[model samples]
Target: MLELIAIFAAAASGDVDQVKSVQQRDEDIVVTGQRTEGSDDYGVSEQRTATRLPLSQKETPQSVSVVTRAQIQDFQLNSVNEVLATVPGVSVLAAETDRFYYSARGFEITTFQIDGIGQPFAFGIQTGSLDTSFFDRIEVVRGAPGLLSFTGNPSAVVNYVRKRPYREFHTTASAQYGSFNNLRLDSDVSVPLTADGSVRARAVGSVLDTDSHLDRYHLTRWTGYGIVEADLGPNTIVSAGYGHQDHDTDNAQWGAVPLLYGDGTRFDFARNSNTGQPWSGWGVIDRQIFGDLTHQFGNGWSAKVSVLRRAIDEDNELFYVYGNPSRTAPEGINAATGEGVFSYPGKFVGPTRNLTIDAYVNGKVSLGGRSHDVMFGIQRGAERYRQDAAYDFGQIGVAIPLSQLFAGTFPRPPFRRSTACTSSTAPRGGCPCTV
Candidate 1:
C-alpha cells in the first residue's frame, strides 16, 4: 500500500515519464490539464430550461385565461360574475340582485365546475354566484372543453381551483369594504401534522355582507374550505378536501320595467319608478357541498375523483296593478257613472331543484421520449322546476256605488265577476283569470 501510494503521488506530480522501452513502461506517467471545481451536472434549472412548456398565448389550440387570487384581491372582486365581467367576450344579464344570466363567447354557460367536477345548477328565479374567497385560482377555457368537461356549454368552461395545504405553517387574513356598504373578512391557516411534514392540513373561511344599489336589497355570504394531504411514499401522494358556501339575499328585485311615454319615447325608469313602491321583492338561499380525493401512482400517472351537491331555495313576490286605459269609462255621469279605474294586485312564486354527478380519470404517459397529458370523463345532470301565483283585489273592496262615481276616482271592478255570472260554462269559484 505504501508503494502504491508513492507511485500514485509521483504520477499525479508529473515526476514520472513514460517511454517505449519495457523498463520505462513500468514507470508511472502524469497527464497535464486544467482541473474544474465540479463536473457538468443535470440540475433542476437545466431541466426546467431545456424542456419548458410554452406560455399560453394567442393562437393556442384553446382560448384560456387565468384569474389568480392576487388579481381577485386587487380588484376586490366578490363574486364569479364580477370577475368574469373583466374578461373579454363575457357578459352577465342581471335579471335581479341575486339572479344572473351568464354568457360567454355568444352562448350561455349554464354549467359550473369546481376542481373540474360538476356542481349543481341553481335553477329558476334563484341566483348562483361563485365565491372568490374559497378559490386559489380560476381557469376559464373558451371553446368546447368537451374532452375534459361534460354537459357544459360549448362556448366555455370555468374551473375553480381550491387552496391546498402546505408542509410549512402559515396564516393570512384580509378585510375589505367597498361601495354599496359592502364588507368582507377572510382568513386562512395551514400547518403540518407530523414532524416529517408528510401530513398537512389547511383551513380557510370568509364572510361578506352588503346592501345593493337597488332599493331595499341586501346580500350575505359565508364560506369554509379545508384540505388534508398525506405523502404516502417518496413517489406517491394522497389528498382529500371539502368546501361549503352559504349565500342569502333579501328584498331582491328582478328588474325595473322599461318605461315608455304615450308618444313612444323612452323614459328613465329609475327616475319614474323611484316614486312607485317596489312592485316585487324576493329572498334567496343557496348552499353547496364539495369533496374530492386524489391519488398519484409511482409512474407518471394519477387519478382524481370529485363530487359536489348544491341546493337552492328562493321565495319571490311581485306586486303589480292590473288595469287597462282603453277599458276606462267616460269622464263623468257614470258612463256607467264614469270614474277612474281600479287596479288589482298580482303575485307570483317559483321554486326549483337541481342535481349533478360527475366522474373522470386524468393521467399522463411517456411515449418515445415525449409526454402526453389526457383526460376523459362522464357526467349526468338534471333539473326540476315549479311555480305558483295568486292575485288579490286591493282597496277597491266591494262594488262601488254609482252615486259615488266621479271623474278621477278610477273605477274598481272584479276581473271576471260579470263573465262568471253570465256564462254557465265558466269554471267554478270564478272565471279563470291570469295576471
Candidate 2:
C-alpha cells in the first residue's frame, strides 16, 4: 500500500509545462467591446406591429414612428398625449382640462394597446391621457389598422411596449418642475428573484401635481405598476401585472367659448382664456390586471397569449356653452351685455368595465427559395359602460366677455329637480340635456 501511494503521488506531480485552469476568476473575463443595442438613435425600428406576418418598420405598408425611450427622456414626455403631439400630422386637441383627444389623417385615434393587446377606449373618453412612465417605447402606425383591432378605425394605431425584466438589477429615478406649479416625479426598479434569474420582478410609479394655465384649474395624478415574470423553462415564460391610475381635476371645462357674438362680431380671444366654473371638473380612477404567457418550440416557432381586465370609475360635473342664439331662444347669448347662457349644469357618474384577450403564433417559413416570417392571430374584446344619467341642474346666466375671461366671475347653478323642459324627447334619466 505504501509503494502504491508513493507511485500515485509521483504521477500526480505533473510536468512543469502541463497546467489546467479549473476555475475562472472575475479578472479573467473583460467585456471591453460591449455596446448598448438600442441607444439613442433617431431612425426606423427593427420590429413593428405584426399582422399574421413579420415585418419591419420600413417593410410595413404604412408610416411608422417609434418613440424610443431616449426621445421620451430627452423631451420629458410624461403622458401619451404629450408624446403623440411630437408626431407629425397628429393633432392633440384639448377638449377639456385634462381631457385631450388625438387625431391623425382626418380621424380620431380610438385604438390603444399595451404589449400588442388592445385596451378598451372609454365612452366619452379623452384618449392618450395615460401616464407614460411604465412604457419602454411607443409605436405609432398610421392609416387603416386592419386586423390589429377588433373593429379597426381609420386613424392611427398606438402600441405601448412595456419594459421587460432582465436577469439583472437596475434602478432609475427622475424629477422635473415647470411653469404653473407643474411638478412630476417618477421611479422604476427591477430585480431578479432567483439566483439563476429565471424569475424576476419590476415596479414603476409616478406622481404629478400641477396648476393649469387656465384660471382656478388644478390637477393631481398618481400612478403605479407592478409586474412579475417567471421563466417556466428554457422555452416558456409567464407574466402578470397590475396597473392603476387615479386622477382628479378642479375647474374642468366641457367646451370653448363661442367664436362670434350675437351681433356677428368676431372676437379674438387669448389662447389661454377659459370659461370653466370653479366647482366643475372630473374625478377618474382606472385599474387593470393583465397576464401573458409565451412558449417557444425548438423549431423557432413561438406562441403568445395576453389578456387584460380593465375597470374605470368617473365623476363629472359640467357647465357647457354652445353656439349663438336667435330670438326664438333669446337666452342663448346676449352680445350687447356679454351675457352667455350655458347649456346645462349636471353631475355625470359612471363605471366602465372591459375585457380583452389575444393570441398569436409566428415563425419563419420557406416559400419558393426565400425565407419569410409568417404569423396567425385572433383577438376578442367586450366592454360595457353604465351610467346613472346626468343631473340636468339647468343652465346658468353668466357674463363672460370675449377675450376677457379673468375679469368675469362665474357662479355654480343649483340642481333643478323639476322636469319642465319643452322637448318631447327629453332624457328623463336626470333631465332633458341638449344644446
Candidate 3:
C-alpha cells in the first residue's frame, strides 16, 4: 500500500508540470479577432480580448477597483464588507454582527448591483450583510456613476458578479475560526448537467457563528444559493438563479455613548463592561431573498433583471436621566439618593420591500475604420419601508440601583433633564422619560 501511494503521488506531480506547460503554450498563442467558430483560435481570441479590455487600469475614465477571487481567498474574507475594506476610499461601519454601514468617499453608498443590475435600497431598515462566497468578482466604480447606474448617491457603486457554471467541473470547501469565537464553513460546486455539455449548474452555501465584543452578544447566519444556465439553440443563452440568507443576533446594543472628561475629551469604553445584566442588551433578526434572470442575443447584445427583498425586526432598551441638582425631592424620596434618574425601553419592527428592473442593449460596430461602442438602457425601481415601534415609559420600572440602571457605573446620576429626550408637554416644565 505504501509503495502504491508513493507512485500515485509522483504521477500527480508529473501531471501538474504537464498542465503548466500547456497553459504556457496557450498564453503564447495569439490570433486575430475575426476567427470562425470551431477554428481552435476563436475561443482563445475571445478570452484574450476579454482579459485585456479592463487591463489598462489608468486609461479608464472612471475610478474603478476590481476585487478578484484570488484576492478574496488570500484575505480569507467571507463577507463583502471584509473584502471592500481592503480597497482604497472605502469604509465599513459595523452596526452589529449581522448589520453593517457602508461609506465611500465620505458619503453613504445606498445602491448596489449584481452583474450590472441595480439592487433596491430601503431606508431605516437593515440590508443584511452580503456573502462573498458566491461571487466570482466585484467591481467598484467610484464617484458619480449617474451615466452607468440610473440613480444613486455620488459616492460609489458596487457590482457583484455571481459565479456561473462553466464547461468544467470543480468543487471547493473551507472552514475558518477567528477572534471573538468566530467560526464559518463554506462550500461551492459547479458542474455540467448533460453529456452535450450545453447545460450547467452551480450551488454554494455557508454557515457562520460568532460572538461580538459587546457583552452577552452573539450572532448566527446561514445562506444558500443555486444557478442554472442553458444554451437554447445557436447564438442564444439563458441563465437564472436564486439566493437566500438569514441572520440572527442576541444581547446586542444599538450603540454606546461617547465618554467625555472634564474638558470634553472622549474615551473608549471597555467592550465587556455590561456583562450579565438585564435591560443592557438587545436582539435583531434579518432575512433576505433575491433572484435574477438574463438572456443573450447573437448580435453582441444582452438584457438582465434582478430583484431582492429583506425584512428586519429589532428590540432595544436604553436608560437616561433628567432633573436639576438644586431642586427639592418629591414625597417619599431620599435626598441621599443620586441625582434624578430616568429609563426608556422600546421596540421597533420594520418590513421593507424593493423591486428594480432594467434593460439595456450594447454593441460594437466599425464605422470608417474606427470601432464605436454604444449602449442604451432604461431602468425603474421602487422601495417602500414600514416601521411599527411600541414606545412607552410605563412598561419600564422606575430607576433603582443606579449602577443597574446604567449599563456602566459612573459618578453622575443616570437621569438628567436635557434636550435629548425632552418634550414640551411635560407637566412640571421638565422632560419626561420617553422611549
Candidate 4:
C-alpha cells in the first residue's frame, strides 16, 4: 500500500510540472467564463425581503421563500396567483374567475410590495391580474417585517422584484399552447446602451388569449414593461421604468350556484353551467411609472430613494342571481314561473391613483468588537379612489327565474342615473356615497 501511494504522488507531481512547462512555453490555451447575472436559477444565495438587510434564507429570522425566474419558467407560472399557489405555507383563495385572496399561517396576507415599497389598493384588493413577465423574482416573507411593512400582519409580506437591465445583451422569448384554447406569447430583451456597458435598457411584454372550460367564458390579457438604467458615477445608479396591464374577462360569474331546492332537496347542476349573461364582463387597466436612485459610500454605507405613481381603472357590467328553486321538476324556475330566484344587475366604474416615496440608508457598524447591521427608512404615500355606480331599485327587487338566467333569455335592464359621485365632479371635501 505504501509503494502504491508513493507511485501515485510521483505521477501527480510530474503532471503538475508538465502543465507548468506548457504554460511557460506560451502554448495556446482556451479560457472560459460564465455569466450569472440575469441568468436562470432555481434559488438565490441572498435576499433582503425579511429585514431589508441582505441575508440568506437560512439566516433570516422569519421563514422566507424565493420563487426565482427559473422556477417560474419551469412551472409556467404566468400570473401572480399561479406563482403564490405553488409556495409552501401560502394559500390562494379564488373569489371568482379573476378575483383572488391570499393567506399564510392561517392569516390573510394584506401587505404587498414592489421592490420593497408598499402601495395602497383602491378597493382593498388587487383589481387585475399582475403578470410575471417583468419580474425577476418573488420574495415571500412568511411573517411580519414590521420595520418596513407598516402593517404588522402576522401572516406574510410578498415583495416582487423587477428585472433589471443586464450589462450584456441578451434576449429570450417563449410561446405556449395548452388545453381550453389557451395561447400565450412573451418576449424579454436586454441591451447595453453605452460603450462601457454602464447604461442599459430592458423591455418585456406578454399577450394571452384564452377560453375557459366554463360555457360562455373567455379572457384576454396583455402586459408591457420597459426600463432604463444609467450609472451616474462609479458607485451611483439611476433607473426609471413604466409598466401597464390590460385585462378583459367575459361572462364572469358574480355569485355561486344554488345547491339545494326550496323544498330542502339536493340539486345537481352541470359543471360547465354558467349563470352570467353573454354581455356581462369586467375590464381592468393598470399602469405605473417608477424611478429609483441608489448611491454607495466608500464607508460601506448605502442609500436609496424610490418613487412610484400608480393608476388603476375598472369597468364592471355584472348580474348577480341567487335563490332556491321549487321542486317542480322540469320548469322549476323558468321565465313564466319565477317562484324563488332573484337578480341584481348593475354597472360600475372605479378609478384609483396613488403616489408613494421611500427612502432608506443601510450600513454595518462595529459594536462591541462585532459587526451589526442597521437600517433606517421612511415612506410617504397618498392615494385617491372614486367609484361611480348605476343602479335601478326596481330592477334589484325584481325576481328572475334561474332557468331563464342560464339560458340568456332575460334582457338587460335599463340603467338609471349614477347614484355614486365621480371623482372629477365631486368636491375636495367629500361626497355622499350612495352605493
Highest-scoring model, lDDT: 4
Badly placed stretches (over 4 Å) of model 3 are: 1-59, 95-99, 124-128, 261-268, 274-299, 302-342, 395-402, 405-435
lDDT of 2 by residue, 94-206 (tens): 76566677788998888877788877665324622688887888888888886777646888888888877766888999999999999999999889999977899999999
For each candidate, what is the lDDT?
A: 0.54, 0.70, 0.56, 0.79
Candidate 3 collision pairs = 321-415, 321-416, 322-415, 322-416, 322-417, 323-417, 341-415
CA RMSD for every model? 14.5, 8.9, 11.8, 7.5
Which candidate leads the pack in TM-score?
A: 4
Per residue, candidate 3 scores C-alpha lDDT tens digits across 285-383 of 544455555454534445445555545444333333332121244421234754334344444444545566666565667899997666666777666
Error of 4 at 282 (Å): 1.2
Task: Give per-model TM-scores.
Answer: 0.65, 0.80, 0.69, 0.86
Q: Rank the candidates by lDDT, best first.
A: 4, 2, 3, 1
User: Which residue pairs of candidate 4 clash?
Assistant: none
lDDT (C-alpha) at residue 184 in model 3: 94
